[model samples]
Target: MLRQVQKQMSLHSILYNKISENHILKKINYVVDFSFINKLLEDSYCKNFGRPAKEPEMMCKLLFLQHLYILSDEKVIEEANLNLGYMYFLGINPEDELPDKSLLSKFRTQRLEEATLDEIITEIVRQCVEKGIIGGTSVSVDATHIEANTIRKTPERLMKHLARKIIKTYEKENNQVLEEIPEVPKYKEIEDHTEAKAVMKDYLENVISKVKKNIRKDCSESIKTKETIEKAREIIEDPKFLNQKGVRSIIDEDARVGRKSKNQEFYGYKTEFMMTADERIITSVRTADGAYVDGTYADELIEQTLKSGMKIEEVYGDKAYFRKPILNSIEEIKAKAYIPVSESVYRIDESEFSYNKDSDEWECREGNITVKKKYYKIKGKSRPDREGYKYYFEPEQCKRCPKHDECAKKSARKILQIGLNTIEFYEISQYQKTEEYLEKYKKRASIEGKNAELKRFHGLYRARGYGLLSVSMQSKLAAIAVNIKRIAAIAASKFCIFTLNIKIFSQYYKFCLN
Candidate 1:
């Protein structure tokens, strides 16, 4: 049954009271508002269940502590049992039994969904915003990699393992030994990497086909064999089962190969964050497979921030986000973008061409001829015209120009593709050349520090668990802990300032009255 413990002046309580008041746990307990979590998770529990569940708020605090101190589940529970500061933060007596590590894992995987986690983050941000700790006007966006928890395996080893598993399962079900399993090709036989990869893929496909044939032939003999065959079929049909690059990891199929530099490659996922520039508060976060490009998800991240009730006046990002669609999305929301233009944009200098909005024509530098607007099918397909406007210069005009050779090759016309957000792009490009843009763009540097903090301090460089969902949960929890710590620091500083002002006022009043 759910019950609240009665207040008592126990020895542990008196000792906690006598402990230093400047402890981080004491400061966090004084400032942070964790009560909202109880309401947020209220619906997750059943009124008529088998047993009264552990309080969700306490469980959330446990998770926050886990990331805040970068402790493992076992270590966190053990520390909570032994440390008075941890017990004080949890509002539990020293004798209280701490929850087991399995229960914490169950709470993370079963009780907390992505939406609930998001809600908790949003509520925390809201409180900070209300208290003027975070200004929601401008935000910087960036992404970092988190290594998955798996050991790298070669294609040959993975294929052999799969084959062996199927063979053992078949033998165990039928109570009969097979003559021999499929043999994997040796690496020495294939000299070229590409050729070897192709051979391995073909061999695996053949093995799967043979296994299916055997299953169909033996289905009538044993139900167990049929069940085994069905499970094997599901594994083979899984989209993440295998790819051209080979299996990323047998343990975590969702992870993909990611390269930070030419020399640094890892198997993991990518986490993107949008944080307020003034306070470094994380506004929104997204998790994707390692193979996803950083620029591809800017639109979604911006939308998520907007949905969380933050007014985005401006966005700052690196050149990785210098794509047409991303710039257009920012303009659609009427927010300014501080992203630097890519070299491709500079190649087509807009200064050389004058656009006529009324006639939909672009006049070249010579002003004697105009480039005509045209729409061509992209990639030789007929449907869904391209997103931007393509302008083609007259071949005759280009041929006569002094810079013809520099601008275009012989028998080729000069063409420029301008997106519908061309005006916005031009504005951004011009602004990038100004002092204001440079100063504003500096804010993007802070997100890099936040990424470093997440990796270096909170253990985000490598994921704590396998699978995309588990890693995503880890990212969110880390973000929450960072925000909570930031809030606590801000609160402590404000309190110090307030106390100093009060003391000064009291001393001044005493002198004036005397």
Candidate 2:
């Protein structure tokens, strides 16, 4: 049930008004009209007839405050009870009782539907657009990683964890400990991971089968036992079960190992977002497993940004977003892509080698030209034939060259592979040399700052709870928090300008009268 609370001015309303107009809480309340939230969440609550529920708006406001200040559930409620600023932000009178902290956890994980979180972000962006704060057409996109809540475990340990969880649940629910349990394997004595995994798998299967057989014939009596057995069976049967990446932990199944760089890896999730350059306000966000490619979400981000009422005239990102499909998606929307070519795809040391566009060959500083070329078509069902080309230099020239050791040590000749879209990338590379591209590309840095702000201030540096759903909500709420902050600053600046104009007009009128 969604209880509608009528807010009449309390005696403390005067004190709330006394909270400086520039106060972050006051500014946020003034700029962000959360009335739309009630309508958006109406379906999630009973229309009537249930115990009077806390207003969805207030519940959501509690969450917003939680993320905005990076407070734990218990801490936020404590602050709201004691702090007048928090009370003003939540729109509750000082005398009004705040809901218990447990209700917040329930509201976040249960009452608030996963899909509604995205709508919440879109609504905020829409408000920004409607308020004329986000009128820019250029948006920057980027992805930041969030560390998983659980520590990573090896495949062997992960299997053991699963087996133990099932057995524990069975024993507790059935109130009978099975004495004839499967014997543990000496996995540490095994040298090969494959052999050890096979033995461990065999052991786990035995344990599961034994538990199922011992369960009372009335298996329907314990749904938890049945569910645990089913979940364990699914994990054991997965194709990637033996691989370390399959299920790192039973607690967080959605998190996966992802590369931050070639040599760096982190187990967690990714939050990809697009924000307007001029306004620095996030327009759209997507959450995915840590291993998800940054470029994969580019199309969705652009689409969502468009849906949020921001016209994207240009899109900016890092080299990871230089894929053909991503660029094509941007082009389809008639937005120019400012993503630089991936270094792995097209990189040449300007001082060492230069490309001759006329001959379609590379020239080394030693004045040697490439003599042979081979086109290696990408063999993939989803990709086009134009993958790239490999250019080979003459072995004889390299053998006789003075810089052979420096340029091609232990090799017969010099070779370079260039992407098939060399022309398009070349044009972008050339444009990268211009003042216009430099100025426009600078907008991409704002997203990095936003990412830092999220991690440093909004508790996005790590997952506060288990599973992707929780992290997704955390990321979106952080985005909303920052957007509200940006909007308030903009509104405050506009107000300052308006006041200055009025003062200037008043001075001019007085001078004329004199």
lDDT of 1 by residue, 318-429 (tens): 8778887887898899998888887654445666766666676777777635557765545436665546667877888777878888666533557767755664556567
Q: Kindly list the per-residue Cα lDDT of model 2 for residues 1-514, writing each as its tens digit.
A: 7767667869876777667889887887766788777888888788877898888888888888888888999999999999888888887888999999999989888889767877877777888788886778898999999999999877777777778888888889888777788878888789998998888888888888887777755363667877987887887788776676667888899898999988999999999998888899888888888888887877777877787787889899998998878888989999899988786656655677677777888777898889878888877778756567788888788779899887756444478777787655766777788999898788899889999999999989899988888888889888888887888898889889989999999999999999
Per-candidate TM vs. native?
0.85, 0.86
Best by TM-score: 2
